[model samples]
Target chain A: MRNQNTNILKATIKDIIVAFICIAIIFFTIYIVWGSEISLAISLVNKISIDTSKKVLEEVKLNSVTNKLESYPEYGTKYGTIKIDAINADLPLYYGDTLAILRNGVGQFSGGYFPGEGGTVVCMAHNSTKYLRELAKVTPGNKIIITTNYGEFTYEVFDTTIVPQTEMEALKIQNEEEMLVLYTCYPFNSIGHTTSRYITYSKLVDSKYF
Target chain B: MVKNIVSYIITMFLILFIIMIIVLNVFSNTILKKEYTIANLKTGNYYERINQNIVDGFKDYTVQSGLSDEVLEKIYSQDKLEQDINSMIESLYTGSKINIDTESIKENLLNNIEIELEKENKEIAQSEEEALTNYMEAIVEVYKNNVLYSEKVVEEIGTVLNKANNIINKAQIVIYLIPLVLVIILIVINHKQLKFLQYIGIGLLATGLFSITPKIISELKMDINNIMAINQATSNLIQTIAQDILNRFTVIGIIMIVIGIILIIIHNVKACRILEETKRSRH
Candidate 1:
């Protein structure tokens, strides 16, 4: 009886081992036949799986040698606040000019430069009451202060005008001088679509880098 | 021992055959079936989410366009939304040209804008004509992009889906026939000692483990909940489909394992009974 029981136990163990071996052999065969294709499929799926676990946005950095930024804030993220005492306006500033970014506060044109980069810093905001409703009221000599994570910049309004919304030349992005070009949809209180942009041009009057 | 080895080899083949069947059936029921994907999208509220996205997107444009919220109202009705979405999905399965019609939307938007302009007693000056056209085009683009998320890739995906569907349909008959032949061979080889039941059970057990392995590895290596896409709606759709497939795999694997264990237990009992009879006859 003891011998029979031992034999039965051994047979059961052998059956399980054989089962596992069979599985390994099947997988091995598949790997040999279609390993590259399987790898390609996995890699394709992995492309869409982003690692949001780590921080990707960093503080804006100015390179004194090139008069350009060594680092820039991630697009769509708030990097600073724009305050205009003349209009009682203070709003978050984002790096991108997407409509979504503009809805939140003010969006800086990605094609333009940062505050300390000695070039045009183009920004735009919605004309709603919560935002730049009093932007048109801002006149020459009014100060627009941009407080960024890296520095504080003050620009004095020198000119204001309404331009056709399609006028790209109105936004002069050059390295000759540090300028701030801010704009919003014109006819601020209108109940319908407006095809004009109310723009305010300012020259950098002060800068304090930290 | 040689006979025993042959039986083991036969059982191995049975396991492979069973795996193929499970895979084919899973694909046929889930990935290959257009209805399954459509059902998943409906259950996930994909259409409603897309509608909300469209509304929010329009609202964003309104901020910079100096347009009131009224211009966007009723641009596309919910019924139209459903129709377009369903039609797009049909195209995906049929490998048809994917075109989300935005002409009606553009016309409706133009009509709405005209009405707004008339109410405000404002006319588009010659200088502003280009801006107005650009604005209209931009709004239409937002609608088109939102309605058909990733349009170019979608066309490629449609082609792939159609090809896969065709291949699965053509290969299905052979997929079903192979396992039947393998099971018959397994029975013929192991029937003398009534060991076919044990071998079949072993095959089932192996198949169950193999079927469930992907879910196990995915759980360990991936954060399925954090699976993302170009936008939130697409992300939610992907996660929903992935979770559903994984759940199905787990359920099928558990069911096979239970059945396999029961068969093995029954075979052991029968073998014990036959052994006892032989012992009694010898005495």
Candidate 2:
């Protein structure tokens, strides 16, 4: 009887051990495959966006701003002609991209209004690529020269600020002074839209194309 | 008595050995790998977001400060008007106290607008030089605020990732040790079941090895990928090798478990048949 009981006990122990091993192997395999797959997918997405931006920048012509009204394209239209050179690199500037000038919510670009009009003109751009990242490195007195079809408008970087998204009034066009406002999302490599906006202010120094 | 004591000691050793195998397999496969991967991803994301927010905040501040004059002028003027109206109301109350005429309050407000307009024009004339300075100062303030915020975000992310990693490490140790403890307890209670317990221990060890092998392979693969992305060529190579070893171990563990289960079942059937035969012979 004792021998039989011992056999039963051995068999039971063997079964339990076998079951545990099976479960562990299955889980381990799954963890490895899933982790690698997710990492690869994320990297691929980031690379694609970077490549696209680089391609677009390469094809665009870099011109100087010469004319004012004649050269000013329609509002909200994206033209690839103007490039802003600041911080030793040239960034493609688009018109009607919404330029908010003030750290406060007031100055913004209106369709017919010129740069000298007393209001802030807000310009928006994507920061995922290198062009916008270059902009993030701008320091005081760094020259931002906007090259338009009509003329080349040069502005000296005077200030930089970070403000909240609720402050849209800071982008409103005000009759204060002609100011060039540049803005992009705060932080270059963030996953989602953040609470604040990055901004730089520059005064119109010269416009040769106009 | 001596035989019983010897058998019990053997039984305890066998049980303890089986438990250790089971625990080691669980610890290596599931807990450690899952925790590390999650911690790394979360920490990376947090830092990325912090950098982004700082940039975005600066953009908004510049835009708003440039445009503040236009928006504030309208709002400021309205506020000034409201203030004047309140003063007039206060004066009216005083007039009733002193017997001064209420019509004079209306006349006083009309004069205030002209004064306010002139003041606004003068301020506007002086604002060009002041605007740039003020705008620059405001931006500097915003930039400072953003820097502080980013630091806080980064610190918080670091803390969470560290805590998670620690917990997972502890869990791995506990899981790996539990089976060994159980085996020891079983051995102390039974004497004659030593060989049977050893078989069971072997099966459990096989089961644990099979279960953990695949997980270990996957984790090693992930570690390799991470190292490769970071340009750590040596680590990547080592991890790749580790991953291969884990894969083979997993397969072997699975086969062992299957064999163990078959043996256990066959043994039980044979034992049952013997019992039946004995009963028939007695009858």
Candidate that would win on lDDT: 1
Please, what are the lDDT tens digits per residue for candidate 1 over residues B114-181? 99889988886675666667767777777777778766777888888778778878988887887788
DockQ of 1: 0.32
In terms of TM-score, which candidate is strongest?
A: 1
Encode model 2's per-residue lDDT on A1-210: one tens digit a residue.
676677666766755654454455444665686968766754553343222223322222323243123334443443423345544445554444433222322222453244433345566554434335456788778776655444466778788887876787655455466567777665553322245677887777765633
Docking class of 1: acceptable
- Best-fitting candidate, measured by DockQ? 1
* DockQ, all candidates in order: 0.32, 0.07
Worst 10-residue lDDT window for candidate 2 chain B reads: B67-76
- The parts of candidate 1 lying over 4 Å away from their true place are A1-10, A51-75, A109-122, A127-140, A149-151, A157-204, A207-210, B96-101, B272-283
Q: Give the TM-score of candidate 1.
A: 0.84
**Candidate 1 lDDT, A84-122, residue by residue in tens:** 998888899988987778878999999888998899999
